[model samples]
Target: MTAVTTDPRTGMTILDEDTCWSLLSSARLARVAIAIAGDIEVFPVNIVVDDRTVVFRTGEGTKLAAAVIAPRVAVEADGADPATGRAWSVVVKGRAERLDRFADIYRAEDLTLPDWTGHPKQWFVRVYGDQIAGRSFETAPT
Candidate 1:
C-alpha cells in the first residue's frame, strides 16, 4: 500500500493506485462495463491482472463486440473481510483491446486465469486506463 486516505466523518479509507492494483491483481471476479451505441452494458468476467491491465475471456456476441469497439471502458472489483466486516471496492477505467498477436496470447497463457463459465471463451481482451480509485469502510451488520 503506497498511500491511504481517510474520511474523518465516516472513517472510510481511500486506497491509492498501487493498493488498487494490488487488490485487482488478487481478485478473480470483476465487472467490466462497456458503452455500445448509446447505451452501456456490464458483464461479469473472470480476470487476471497482467502488469497494470485487466484481462478476461469472452465468446462471440455483445461482450466481444463491446470490447473491440468501445472507445473507453471500466473494470471494477470488490471484496469484504468477514472478520472485520470491512468492504472495499476498486475501479479501473481504460481502453479495451483484444489480444490478437501470437506473443501476447502466449504470454497470457502463462498466467493463472480462472474461468467459471463452461462455455468456450476464444477471445481475450484487456482493459487498461489511467484512472483507478478505491475505498474501504466498515459495513453495518445485516
Candidate 2:
C-alpha cells in the first residue's frame, strides 16, 4: 500500500508535484469533454498523459471532426479516498490539435495505450492544457 500526503495550503487536498506526476503517469483512462455547438460531448478514452499533454485515439467521424475544429476542450480524472471519505478531481482546459510529425516523435517515447481496436481510419489527437484546476472534498469523521 502507498500513502499520499496532503498539502496544508489548499484544504482542497493538495497533490504534491511528485504525486501529481505519478497519478498522471499511472492513469490509463480519462473522460474528455468538449463543448460542441452549445452541447456537451463526453467520451471515455484510453489516454497517454505526458506531463501536461493528453493524447488519445479517435475515429474520423465525430470526435475527430469536432477536435479538428473545436477551439477549447476539457479533460478530467479523479480518485476516491476511503479513509477520509473524500475524493479528488483534476481538470485541464486547453486547445486540441492533431499531432504533427515532430510532436509525434517527441511524444512517442511515452506513448502508452491499450492495444487499439482494429480501426484503420482512426487518428490520434492531443490536448495541450493551458490551464489546470483541482478540487477535493471530505466528509467530517463520524
Candidate 1 to truth, TM: 0.94
lDDT of 1 by residue, 6-108 (tens): 9889979999988999998889999999888889999899999998988888886888888888858999999988898888899999898888999988887
Residue pairs with clashing backbones, model 1: 94-128, 94-129
Q: Which portions of model 2 show Cα errors greater than 4 Å? A: 1-11, 14-22, 100-110, 115-121, 139-142
Per-residue alpha-carbon lDDT of candidate 2 for residues 1-142, written as tens digits (9 for 90 to 100): 1225445664456554455545655667778898888898887777788756888877657788788778588888776668768766677789988765876856643576662455543467888888766656574575
Q: In every candidate, how many clashes are there?
A: 2, 0
Candidate 1 Cα lDDT to native: 0.87
Q: What's the lDDT for residue 67 in model 1?
A: 83
Error of 2 at 64 (Å): 0.4
User: Which ranges of candidate 1 are over 4 A from the true structure?
Assistant: 1-3
Alpha carbon lDDT at 123, candidate 1: 81
